[model samples]
Target: MTTPFGLSSTATTNTLVLGQKDLEIIQPPDDAISCLKFSPLSIPQTYLIASSWANDIRCWEIQSNGQSVAKAIQKHDAPILSCCWSEDGSKVFTAGCDKTAKMWDLQANTFVQIAAHDQPIRTIHYIQRPSYSCVMTGSWDRTVKFWDTRQATPLKQLALSERIYAADVFGPMAVITTADRNIQVYSLDQGPTEYKKIESLLKYQHRCVSIFTDKSKNPNGFAVGSIEGRVAIMYVETANPSVDNFTFKCHRSTPQPPTNTQDIFAVNDIAFHPIHGTLATVGSDGRYSFWDKDDRTKLKTSDVIND
Candidate 1:
């Protein structure tokens, strides 16, 4: 069978699902994937990096014809929890249960430990600015640290209300969620000070978050997902009565013939489209959905995946 992208199912064992236009990698991680990110748009080639519970990170270059070629692999002593690519797409950073974060340089082909925490690192993000560039890491240690990567110690560290659960950074804005249901917004322009602190709108534990821009492409607000199968669209400035925040239910299955209750699955991750500003979410129900946040409507929902 031949795919629309010119890939054949029988030609290579590295690819799969010819009819649906899905192509599986040759050898995936042994355990569950913790995080995945693509290279910055400035990069000409499409490169993907994935971290896993198998205690390793893998990179692949996706070709123009839909073929995927293995590029690089790096390892940690413990399971990795998060990973991100540098703004220039020249480097990758990963954090994990090993209590440390590592930087992988694609040009030099070197992997080195760049930061450490008292407890397992939960999430990491790369922040690039005109004056400086740094990696921001959140940990179960109840703190967020900013690292220069070249230094042995962090340049700045801020205490949080509780252990970090999820976080995201876009431009100069950063949003962090903790185990105690606290959400703190930060303006990196002010040197990492707390800009606003609020409780999560969801009733359960925070699972994921992503910062998004408004029509002007300015950092306006963010979307948060929770274990209760709900998501909240939040604005940085709630003082304006015209801009409102809202929550909605998703990743839930309909009741069967005999039962009146639905099965609710945790929302695992949320991402914003770079060009369109639309939102995308993936849940434990093995389904993904796209939404127009501005209109408060669901654009599309995918069928549940078997795998």
Candidate 2:
């Protein structure tokens, strides 16, 4: 199929007739999954790594024969709260409630761990470039730290006023959300002194954050999730930055609200497809939705995940 943007791709999507979801199975640790991410397309085989509250991280490799093998890697002293892969997929970064971060070298079978913070680390992000290769971590200690692969400890840290909940870096921009309903967008230009933080007009506590979709290696903006079932799309660079940003309510009760009240649920996750501008979201209410932010259209909405 070809989109109006001249992008083409192949897919095998079936028409979902009922509210039930497409065939799937539940598989993972005995504890809750804190983070899950698929490997980059540059890798030969597709694999998924999931971090858990059990202090163990697991990986699943899909074989050519359609079978899959899973492996558990344990090292964290406390619950593993978040995980992310290096841009090249050579290493995986994980942070946990143990107040530490660790790097797992997949091929070398070696791991390096370090004390990351005084409080539990909530998020981890990897941005690897020829000139700059570093891992960024956000924690409940109310700070964001940057770790260089060449150093044994973090080289720089950015302090904020609230507990960090989620973070993501795309190209030269980074967006981070916190429990205080603040969304901080940073400029990843040069050194620590050159970094800039943008002001946010959000009013609800944020849950997740993700950069916008782009195949040309540049992102226009990012989306922020809140506990009130709202997603805010914010642009970093624009003629009128405030006017370019917007928010919408979603994944809540379909029927009318009660007299003088409204139903509220947390937006669990938000991800943008690389080839298309389609934004997919999951909510604590067990409902999922697909939206085209470019066109302001709701593509799909289904109550497939029962609470």
Which structure among the candidates has the greatest TM-score?
1
- The number of the candidate with the highest lDDT is 1
For candidate 2, the TM-score is 0.85
lDDT of each: 0.88, 0.76
Model 2 ranges with Cα > 4 A deviation: 1-27, 63-67, 192-195, 213-215, 256-262
| Model 2: worst 10 consecutive residues (lDDT sum) | 3-12
**Residue 157 error for model 1, in Å?**
0.7
List clashing residue pairs in candidate 1. Answer: none
Model 1 TM: 0.92
Tell me the lDDT of model 2 at 67: 42
